[model samples]
Target: MVHTQEYESLLPTKNTKHSHRRRSFIIIILVTIAILLGTTLGLAYGFIYWKSRCIKTHKHVQLKHVLPGSFGIEFKLHTKNTSDTSTENDITIKWEHEPKDIRYRQKTEEMVSNDSVLTTVTIVNNNATVSYELGNETCWLNPDNSSIFEWYSILPLIMESVRSNHREDGCRERMWTTTYNGRRVFICIIDQRISYIRYDNRVAQSQEWMVPSQSSIKLPSDATKCGMMDSEMTSLLVVDDDKRQNTSDSTRQQLSYSQTYRKDNEYLKQPEIFVRSAKPDCLFIHGIGVKSPKTGYKSLKSMSYWGHIEKNTPQCSSHKFIQFNTVDNGWDSVSLHKMFCEFATGSNVDGRISNKIIFTHSMGNNIVAAALHRKVCSFDVQSSKWFSVSAPWRGSKVVLKLEDLCSGHLGPSHHKSENLLWLVLEHTKYCTHEGKMSPAYRTLHPTYKSPTGISYDDLVAVARLHVTGALCGTSPWGMGLSLSFSGTLKFIQSFSHLDQPNDGVVALNSCNVFGKKFQSIAKFALMSVNHLESSMKFGCRKPLCSWYQIL
Candidate 1:
């Protein structure tokens, strides 16, 4: 009885027990508050670190982690690898990924392609020339755009996979087990520093966190000058991942010649901004009937031509323009091609020219097309792009309309529009080659000898020259005509001589479509614009859907 009473008293009184409970509850609340405060502080520190940290402490590359699990690759090629045999401008891209088609099973278990280096890229006259297995299939990139040859292109998927795995041991180990160009990669992180990016996957599979810095990283020396920002990188990730997930496997295989790279749906949602551009050294060639006080590429006089195209009209950041005057020579398209080859060959300040972007308006397209088809000009077809505006691929009937008006078929009584007099005067006076219409004007005729020396009736055969990036034609900004007065479209639309959809001077069929009718085409392909505005800048506003922007 005595032992039991002693033990019970020692246990506690009601007030004492209440006081002890209160103390315990206070301690628990304090501990929780401290933990939450610490967590908030840790997150803040992490955010700051992510915003400003280098891929290496030496700032070899800048990786700005803008979103959680979102990745970016900012190339900073400040150091020249004197130890390397390759030039500083050379960027050898080593890439590999999973097999495009699972059905195309590998002979070995590796599922790797036979080639390891996807491409060896070099800057030749400011254009990125890619030397790879698929040589001609590759397009030229502006050397200032470095997204393709960066490590972070493949990082988003790896980061997303790791982010999803809640049970990961915090080592943040990721392995691309499948082969890309005969190489499997292992990417791992230690002490929150990314390390161990090698084609061999053994170390990552083993989960050894102690990975030394990879010495094989090399980028083009001009990488630091690239224009694509972090938001663009995020957008690229979103678009690529979306296409990969949504498209059927068979469809994907059919769309691609070689699966250079691809991503799965596991990637986090990317931001809604993306851009790609090619602002190479541009050679602008003007169309027929270029009048006096001739606004060369320097004058910026004709918005109808590419005047102020790089800024006010078709905006791009870095493009070097060389304007060629249409009236500089009196030759036809065939003669112009030969003359152009000689001029282009000798015009090189550096004594060599390849991969120069050609910007043509009207008849210039045909002349350049002939030169390219005949291999007369030495433009690197594998890296060059041809952007033709107001291209009369099928030949316009409006030239006939002008010829009739000039020949007095439409008498002075019939022609009340003074624009008719202006056309006849300009075409005859400024653009005269013979007693009649100039050779440039004749080249615009549907039945004339084409620049290619082929019958213009076989328009498809003449229009079949291919470049790596061929940008063709532009839609007329629906407004007042460049040559004539108001209601000109209505006049041309009503004219017996002009029966088709005409852009005042060039018919729509001639400028863009060459008789192959489809129910749907890209919106950029659709013609005509602006019913309300009377602006005479009737050429295309911009090539918004160009491969430089949309692709």
Candidate 2:
């Protein structure tokens, strides 16, 4: 009995040891899991912080913020109006690199009845001093949200045109002038080379506006001028009450033609020999200012088309070209189409040649779109090629906004036309007429009807005058978004619906051709290139001399 009892005690001891071992195993597993969980949580938090920092940096880059040391150092000046004359001696600008000597200049001038003051800063390094004009109207504009501010800022070229000639005897175009924040201002942007009229009171001289460097910023192409004009200037007729009265007196003519045309009226073309060799066959249209040709040439070599309309031939030698002219900006597409079909589409004076490829630019593009939609041309759709460059198929947004403010004094069609005649008409109506643009439309229709028997290659060269200064106000994607989006969406909503290729400013998918997505094809593409680059490749820069000399 004693032996059996001892054996039982040993068995119990063994069981107790086994239980302790089991408990240790479970505890080890729990500790391992806890450590892993803590590590995972720490890693997740670190990743979140890293991602947030990256996003912040990207945002800054988009906003054009130069990273510290990117431009060597951050430099800026804070300007404030001062009335405490005694503080002038206390004013000290602690610049990182101080100017050798700094001097301030001020001028006061009267405008109509009010006096305006302009201030400038001059910095001298030894005897060489750089004079900087600060208070010029454009430079000193109150920097406000008013249209007067935005318009003058974006359309400097247009404003320059009005200022230089609008008040002269040759030019009597009415213009809108308004005072903003106690200062008078106008909206125009002409080339920097052109001279402008001085303000009635010469408080400040016009300063050379600063254009942004391409490495840091990209500006719109049309913000500056391009191309050249004819040496033998064509005259334009101006009719006004004063001229009318003078003409009725039987001593002076009712209207006299001036020997100059707006820079927009000019053209550049290739040599006659080069044109004829490319495609003895092409079609051409004439716009309002274009005169009727006496006869058609047998080939592009003998082509007598206005030099300006065919100036692009050097770059487009691979394809045949045609030209069409509209009667100024006022002629409707229907009328222009009819004239093209009857006068331009047929053979020359002897009527022996065949109709060829159709092409147009500016107002001519508008006519072509109208013509194809109306089935005015009866060519094979597959074989025919249609193209246009810098065509503002959709109207300008600025014009529509101005019309809204003027209470029906400008129409959608006024700014809607991108060509010279259209702009002139729109300006005259809003500046002189009394129409309005309501229900702002931006961008051309994304899904437009392709003209029967015509494959359209539409190209848009965006202008800075319309894009800058109002990012939030104007649509980001140029003109008509809804019209473009819905039209494009409708055209490309299904692959089963398309029949050809299409190209928008840079996005292939925006075009509606060949029943595919905007950019589904290898052969068909939509792309965007810098306007200056395009001008260089095509030799669009004027004076030909500038092409070689200026560079």
Candidate 3:
């Protein structure tokens, strides 16, 4: 009996051990699951937060601040809806007066699509409240839903017209127009920049314009003064007209293929081997990505067309190439405008104002267009011709991709082990994004329709010619990424949204604008030449010298 009792006790102890083991195993699995779930949720939250921050940062607007004083301001609102259905009543305007101490008078007039709804508002008291608003589903102002209360002392324009019978003496008035969302808007200023804005002749909602002035009020004449300052004391090198004509006549005949240089000429001492003309008639403007001397590349001299132009176009052999500091400072449209203004107004080598034939590549086209839009170039009587090659009239979508990649929104899947590699990739992408968002890109973006007064037809009036290359083959390396199995896969994945043929850099569809009103002189299907090669002849080991034949 004693032996049986002892054995039974041992059996119970063994059973207890088995139960303990099973419970431990269950606890470990639950803990592991909880850890995994926490990690996933954390990553998801981080991604969402980052995305929201990006959107908010991009949406925020920067407004200018103007002082509070007795001023006359006019509001001109224009709206357009491309939908078949009209959005006439969908638009609304609101205004506010601050401190409730100022008397306001307003007048509103409605006009056609191209016309503006003129509103003249007058402020009677100093330190008055002024604010303006526009409401519509689709249309807004240049800065978008922004009120000028901060920038100008005017509440909104509420007067009938400065030319009306109730005009005040010494009330200076000026008008400026801007186009936004298919709408043309005009703002007029009178004695004091104070105007009341209302929707459909309704009373404007008033708010106190109490913000402290950051700067003095800017008058219309200030703009004219600035323009004059830009043109003041400028130097120009002019080519003699008689010499220019002789150069043109002498080189009118095309050079035979045999006359072209295929290999390095031992007898040639300088990089420029072409024959020189007595005078230059054409101006050569290089495209974006043109490196400066600081970058170890001679801006214009490095270009494949540099040599070709000298060799082929006798009119350009002796011309001074316009070497813009594009690589270092970026191709800023405003700067280009000033440069063109100087060029157009400044005298040539012979101290005479002369018409020019412009040849541009890539983003150089944007500079040409901007100069024309700003009227910097006198298009009257003078026959100004423009030749654009690989013009990204609609901008490149690759910029958006590069921006995303730099922002870490797109990249190789992240792993703890590859964190260092990921950082390097991110840095490279950021540099590329910063390097490429030139002013030219901003102007070329699809959303940035040409300047208010400019059109393709207007450009064509200057006799524009466009050349684009298509049928580009797959690049071994694209935008600094290898095209191995994994790299190519990533390349495709990154640019999967692009559907048209690209010259390694720019899509064929985005290369030129085509319409009933717009057409290219010729389209070449160069299977091997990519975007850079289209304008950059020496881009490849065996340079595509043949491509320059079109010039």
In model 3, which regions exceed 4 Å deviation? 1-282, 290-315, 325-332, 341-357, 379-385, 408-440, 449-496, 514-528, 537-544
CA lDDT of every candidate: 0.36, 0.27, 0.36
Ranking the candidates on TM-score from highest down gives 1, 3, 2
| Residue pairs in collision within model 1 | 96-180, 97-180, 478-529
* Candidate 1 residue lDDT tens string, 312-392: 324232444333445543324454555456545554122233555555656666666665555555555555545555566
Worst lDDT 10-window in candidate 3: 136-145
Q: Each model's TM-score?
A: 0.39, 0.28, 0.35
Whole-model lDDT, model 2? 0.27
Off-target runs (Cα >4 Å) in candidate 1 are 1-279, 291-304, 312-335, 342-353, 408-415, 419-436, 450-452, 457-462, 467-477, 480-486, 489-493, 512-524, 529-551
> By TM-score, how accurate is candidate 3?
0.35
For candidate 2, lDDT tens digit of each residue in 115-193? 2222222111211111112122111101011121111222222222222223433224332233432335432223322
Candidate 1 all-Cα RMSD: 25.4
lDDT of 3 by residue, 1-551 (tens): 99999989899899999999999999999999999999999999999999999777544411112323332222333322121111121112222233333333333332212232222222333322111111210110011011112112233322212222222233344433333222333333333343333222232222333332212221111110000011121111122223222212211211111112222121122222223333425666766644444322222332333434444444443444666545443333555556644554462122222445556666676666656555555443233334466655556665554433333332333322122222223222222333233333444444445545554444433323322222122221222111111122223223424434444345555543443222222222222333443443322222233333332
In angstroms, the error of model 1 at 103 is: 66
